[model samples]
Structure formats: C-alpha cells, structure tokens
Target: MTAINLAKDGLWKNNPALVQLLGLCPLLATSNSFATSLGLGLTTLAVLTLSNFTISLVRGLLDEETRLPVQILVIATFVTLADLSLQYWFFDMHQRIGLFVALIVTNCTLLGRAEAFASKNPIISSTFDGLMMGTGFLLVLLLMGTIREVAGNGTLFTNLHLLTGTPDMSIQLADSGFLLLALPPGAFLTLGCLIACKNVIDGALR
Candidate 1:
C-alpha cells in the first residue's frame, strides 16, 4: 500500500479499535483516565512495533502451519520485555497497568498485524504498519479516556503522578462530575458515541 493509504487505514479506515474492534478489553478497562490510557497505549505501541519487525525478519521460516504459534512466541517475548522494562523504569505505572501489559500478548491487534502484514511484507513496511496501527489504537484510548475523565471526574489526567511521577499535574475542571461516566456503562456509552461520530463524519466525506 502507498504510505498515505497505509496511514489512512491505520488512523481511520481500518483502526484497530473503531474499525476492526480488536483489543476492546484493555481499551475500555484502562481508559477511565488519560494517564492510564496514554501509558497502556505507549506500551502497546512499543510491543507492536518490535514484534512486527521481528516477525518480518523471520517470516521466511514460518509457514501456515507454524505461523500462529511462532507469531505468539515472538509477540510474547516482546510483551515480556515490555513488562519487565516498565516495572524497572516506571514502577508505579507498571503497577497500575501491568496486568494489561501482560494481556497484550493475547491482544489480537498485535498478532493480527504480525500474521497479516508483517509476515507478508518487508521489515520497513511491517514496522510502519505496526506504528500506524498502534497510533490509531492510542488515539482512541486517549479520546475515550479524556471524555470519561472530563465528564465523570471533572478533571483531566487525575492521578497522573502515577505515570509521570510529577506532583500536581492534573487539571481540575469542576468540584463535581457525573458519576456514571466513570463506570463501565459509561465507557460503553462513550465508545458508542465515538463510533457514531466517526460514522457520521465518514458518511459526510463520502
């Protein structure tokens, strides 16, 4: 694919969260706050990029029969590295999102890219695909987290110290906020609205 088309696919047309709807578990569970979303998003991004590049390098040795298990082994290796690195450098953030980090190995988004794109393409293209796809996923997480935090908590980036380790970094907008938006039902509602808005925009453009 052309670079522009690849970018469009990742950012809009075939987004992992909105279009493909892969990886919604962590997308909803940890997206209640901006910091958590950003943290997990970056972690996923790193894993995807590395896994895709590595898979592309070894694609020749992989056949249809061995592809699935080999892909998971490659992805799991990177996920473990990401998990350990986070714990060492960003212990607090690790503590908060560690479970989700471990879960990235099971995330179809990563494995799908490895099997569908990385295994069929050159290293450079696979790496770019991983980056773009990861960025799309990150954008959705950030948007959902922002909406939920702003509407539910009347703040943005609350408890951000968990990620940045800086004091007084959160922006407080109001004393009180809607409680429902902070819960699971609220995530579903926010995601539904987002999908609707995306569809409306796409339809208008078309």
Candidate 2:
C-alpha cells in the first residue's frame, strides 16, 4: 500500500473512533482528563497490536468456526499483560484512568482487527494496521481531553508533573474558567470540533 493510503486508513477511513466507531464506551467515559485518556489509549494500543500479531500467527491453523473465540482468548491474554504492565509502571495514572484500562479486553478495536484483517492479511500488514488504528484512537482521546482540560480549568496541561515529573507544569489560559468545558457535554462538543477539523484537513488534501 502507498504511504498516503496507509495514513488515510489509519487516520481517517478505518479509524477506530471516527470510522469503525469502536470502543465508544471508554472513549466517552475516561476522556475527562488528558492524562487519563492518554493512559488508557496507549494501553489499548498495546493490547490491540499484540493480539493482532498473535492472531495472525494462528490464522492458518485455526478453524473458521472457532476463530472468534480463539481471537478473544488471545486478546484477553494480551490485555491482562497490558493491565499488569501499566499497573506496575504507571500505578498512579492507572488509578486515575480506573476501570477503562481493564476494559481494553472488551474493546472492539482489537477484536475487529483480529476478525477482519489479521485473519486474512499477512502478519506485517496486520501489525501495521493495528498501529495505525490504535494511533487514531489515541489522537482522538488526546484531542478531546486537551480541549476539555484547557477550557474547563484554564490550563492546557494542568498536571504536567504526572507526565514529566515537573511540578506545576501548567500554562494558565485566563483568570476565569468555563465550567462547562470540563463536563460530559464539553467532551461531545470537543469531539465534534475535532472530527470537523480532521474532515476539513482531509478535504483540503483531497
């Protein structure tokens, strides 16, 4: 595939968020903060990629009737490892992100790839697809989380310390804050604006 198409597939056409629209439950839930959203997004990405690789390896030997069950087992295994890895290294962030981290097992993103792409494609292609799809979801989460945090709290990155180990790494936007920006409604508004922005960029390129 061409680089341009690869980008389009990952960022637009086959996007886990905008196109496939998978994993909306966690996407809408933990996006309250940039840190929380980013943490969960990366965790999901790792699980998806690993599971896709595993499924691609077993594709030839697996029967069609049992393919989905086998795929889920593989995905669940990776998700467990991912959860433990995150809990060990990013305990605080894990705590902040909460149940959304564990929900990666149920994320349609991984299962969709295993069923739709990996079962047919070569391992290399399947792995690349996972990376791209995972990245698209991460991009959406970060975009929405950043906007909400910035607008609602008057800080672009309120707790950069958690990410950078620096204390009070925040830039104030204004003295007064827009309370609504931190709420659930703000998430929807920010996501809409983000999708609109992506569409505009896509149009320009086209």
Candidate 3:
C-alpha cells in the first residue's frame, strides 16, 4: 500500500476515537471546554507519536510475550514527559485536567497501535500512523469541544489565559449559554448526535 492509504486508514477510516471507539474515558470526561480538549488532544498526540516511534524501534527485539509490557512502559515514559511539560508550562490547564492528563499513558489507543500496527511496522510507517491517528483523535476532541463550549457556555474559545492570556477571566458570549450542554448527559447526547450525523453523511455520499 502507498502512503496515502496509510493516511486514510489513520485519519478517517480507522481512527482510534471515532472509528474504533478507543479511549472514551478521557474523551468524554474532559471535553467540556475547548481549552481542555485541545490541551489533552495535543498531549495525546505527543504520547502516541513518541510511543509509536519507540515501539517500532524495539519491535524486532521483543516477542509477543514481552511486547505489551514494553509498549506500556514506552507510552508511560512519554506521557510523563507530557504531564510534566504541561505542569511546568501550562500549570493551570494541568491543574484543571488533573489525573486525566497523566492517564493518557493508559489510553488503549496507544497500546492498540503497539500491538496491532506499530509492533510489526517500520519506524516511518508507525510514526505516520501515530500522527494521523492522533490527528483523528484531536479532530474528534475539537468537534466535541466546540459543541460543548458553544452549547454549555455560549462561547468558542473562552479561557485563552490558561495557555497565554489574562487570568481569572474569559470573553463571555453575548447570548445565554445552554446550561444543559455542560452536564454529563449533554456530552452523551451531543456525541450520539455527532455519530449519527456522520453516519448519515457517509450514507448520503455512498
């Protein structure tokens, strides 16, 4: 297969979050705000890319027996780096996300690739897989974040200070936010609607 096929598989056809439904715990739990989702999504991207690279490098040395443990170790290492970086740089966002940020190490998408794709693939391919898969994950996170933020708070990018802006504040939306969208039930309902919409669009294209 060509590079394009790999891209298609990772980005749209076989995304960890949207297609395979992996890593829903963090996906659903922390996507109430655009900042939170973007922060987590980027961190997950870094972990997935780094873990994929490391796993591909060691694929030849390990057997199936030792690979899973080794893969987790690799993922954990990068996740720690991501976690500390967030703590040091974006301390507030780190505090807001709490343990969920560190838990990206345990996310199945990272391990799934280790066992399913990265373990057998070359480094270059594994890297591409990680990047595209992470992009897919980030895309879903951003979509959910947009819906949640707009619906919950009637704003798109409210808390810019967490990254690089003023503290204790945000640009308020002119209209009243839908309080229901901020709730847990709202997340489930919105996600279900998103999936249904995607399916309908796919069906229409077909």
lDDT per residue as tens, model 3, 1-206: 46798788877778787778898888888788888888899889888988999999989999868888888989988988888898889988888886898889778999998889889999999998888899889988889988888888887776657876566445567476887887788788778887778778778989
**Model 1 alpha-carbon drift over 4 Å, by segment:** none
Question: Which candidate should be chosen as best, given TM-score against the real structure?
Answer: 1
Name the lDDT value of residue 23 in candidate 2. Answer: 88
Across 43-123, the per-residue lDDT of candidate 2 in tens digits comes to: 888888788888998899999799999999999898888878777877766677758777887888889888988899888
Misplaced by over 4 Å in model 3 are 165-170
State which candidate has the highest lDDT. 1
Instruction: Give residue 156's lDDT in candidate 2 (0 to 100).
Output: 70
Ranked by TM-score from best down, the candidates are 1, 3, 2
lDDT of 3: 0.84
Off by over 4 Å in 2: 1-4, 163-168, 200-206
Give the alpha carbon lDDT tens digit for every residue of 143-190 in model 1. 999999999999998777877777968999998789899899998898
Clashes of each: 0, 0, 0
Which model, 1 or 3, shows the larger TM-score? 1
